[model samples]
Target chain A: MAVDGTRPYGAYPPGSETEQVGIMTSTVTILYFAALREQIGRESQVATLPAGGMTVTALLAQLGQQDPRVAGAFAAEPRLRVAINQTLGGLEQIVRPGDEVAVFPPMTGG
Target chain B: MSVPGAGVPKVGSPEMGSPELDSLGAGIHVAVQEAPFDTASEIARLSALSDRTGGVGLFFGQVRGGNGLVSLTLEHYPGMTEKILHALAHEAVQRFGLLGCTLIHRVGTLRVGEAIVFVGASAAHRGAALDATAFLIDRLKTGAPFWKKEEFADGHASWVAAREEDEHAARAWSQDTPPPA
Candidate 1:
């Protein structure tokens, strides 16, 4: 079964998440900033990934479930950008343990 | 301090004293900090490092006062910030034959009328130096991992939104394939 609030688009069945009961999960550091930080009420938090590995999109889905406000932010997908360990990253990027992931709005710097 | 060029490719001829080689020390210096910098002194230092430098082009981005913004705050990804700036400077040096380059961006809370960014490029000719300076500034505006939040005089605050015009400006460099000689 998919973790409640963690699955976006319902790509996988909810109960399927339990199939990995014997498998190991990975940890990822997720950071929020600016408006996201304000909305989420924290700068950073650690998230657990599925047994195999989670992509940035999957991570967002997981985080979106953790809080209604976070879920609302993701409603504006494609408008949000993320960074994996400080470099600009995309949804397809696989997240591994010890990786620091940052989610924020589009940059407006010169 | 030296700018770390991680993913940025090495550029400029060996004789040009690129910081990439390190033997002659780094000609490209980048800094991302909370403290303000002495713009004139910094430009002077970059100019003195490269003997072949004939023209030094400089640009300063400042927070405009009376523009409804009372204060501004900049946020960036730590390690990635310097790396990206170094990469931009590296490309400028290699693409335009720059003898040296310097980039500085300030973070934390800043008041209206304070300088926010500084970019300088030095080359044997004015064209190269000027072009490189433009390239660095334009790219930094869109490519860097920095974000800006503006606080109005009335206490209202909002994140500065990314503009399509800025993206269009950055895309020009990529679209101009083969680059003008």
Candidate 2:
């Protein structure tokens, strides 16, 4: 809920993640896995969150705004799993600065 | 370096990397790698790790053929995979009164009939070791961060979905009682 209402949800405005650079308050490295990774076309990317941190749900919601492909990926799958750092996390988990967040589909390996 | 989509699923961070230790302790041996492991060597290692090992149980899983499946790819979060697998192995040792335990999962492309996973447990009695062996794999199927994607000979591939049965099995272990010390 800490996301700024004035600006839009997507981290970069065409490239806000890198354009704003040093001005952003919180930066998180987001990781993609499994089907999501295949769809996103990248393994990992950095994103920014407004001050005071935001819930994992909010972060994903923001990332969903990145572009049509990202948006489509989030919209396509409803059961996206999340983890803060390496431990599994709930939707309400508060993602803070410098956190390594992972988003992936449900596990199926034996 | 991990080449994500290059068909080679790497284990651990590029810098941190998977630890090559044979066994961290007398009670736990966990590894996430791409190479096919020697099951006999692993069982012998676990047996020799503890002096009281009287019962050693093992379960080895391989990629199944048929259904037009050509190969299967396993994906996992490097650092997290290692951490969780080790924790589960340690827990089984305690919960089953096991003298030692082993859990290994292979990542990357595995053709049909190729080995994919190995779970083993050793204890003072047959019952504890047997139950622990089951517990280790059941819990791992649900708790571990690994994911499986199946590729068909028809040129199609899809990630496997999680199964409810695995979740139930992992939970059943929680309710079961451990053997007496």
Candidate 3:
């Protein structure tokens, strides 16, 4: 089950000074849907972020590096949208601990 | 005027409790389920919900055949999809003066020609009903958080890409679509 966390994207107050500088890390749940799921070969996974946390864009970059296929898949399309806790999110959205992040292609549902 | 099957349980009512409406809210009913739904019964239920309803317009979207298509699978963001559908339905009811609205979208593997989605809108006049129906379907295509992937008889599968045309269709409704007299 995906954990629900408070705080919307871009609303994360920079963590306490001690928590910054990679002193503390947070676990975030990342979910894949549609083609991205196929490319990632899994539905969801837990990833640890650097102490200060990272933007959705940076997380995607890090995920891409971890899996070249992910990098290729995202690099192929610029329209991929992300959601934080099921709400439409932007690349700059912050991903904090316990947040469920979903990345997928533009919606094709009717 | 009474609809043919208006006696059926109204959607979201105690007798008709469905996963569609986790919490009974007024005027809008949304379901994102994997099971096939009875379109006639759903329409009947929607029509029965409001005494002032003059017409009920419904749209059923089915999987298209061809392109060697064997089956199609739909995936959605669970919690978000329901919220998004509710938002769309609420907007339709307000903008089109609808007495009630119903939206049900099926997920999971589905065969060609199977109903993939349905939208029903009830209003005091045919104009509102008809326009709201179109608006709901158009907006649902692009606004909802669902994705489709098609599999071919030859064992090949591909994700369905969002079409520019669908966005255009949804956008058309944004400019205050006039209700036909």
Q: Which rank order by DockQ, best down to worst?
A: 2, 3, 1
For model 1, residues B30-68, the per-residue Cα lDDT tens digits are 887778899889889877976787879899998877768
How much RMSD separates candidate 2 from the native structure? 8.1
CA lDDT, every model vs. true structure: 0.72, 0.74, 0.75
Over A15-73, each residue of candidate 3 has an lDDT whose tens digit, in order, gives 22212322324777676677887776666656788767789999998888887877887
lDDT of 2 by residue, A1-110 (tens): 22222322111122233234334447877777788877876666778777788999899888887656667887877888898877899999999877778898877778
Clash numbers, per candidate: 6, 3, 0
Report the number of the highest-DockQ candidate: 2
**TM-score for the second chain in candidate 2?**
0.83
TM-score of chain A of each: 0.71, 0.75, 0.72
Ranking of candidates on lDDT, top first: 3, 2, 1
Q: Give the root-mean-square deviation of each candidate in angstroms.
A: 8.5, 8.1, 9.4
> Candidate 2, after superposition: displacement of residue B168 in Å?
1.8
iRMSD per prediction, in order: 11.9, 9.3, 13.4
Which scores higher on DockQ, 1 or 2?
2
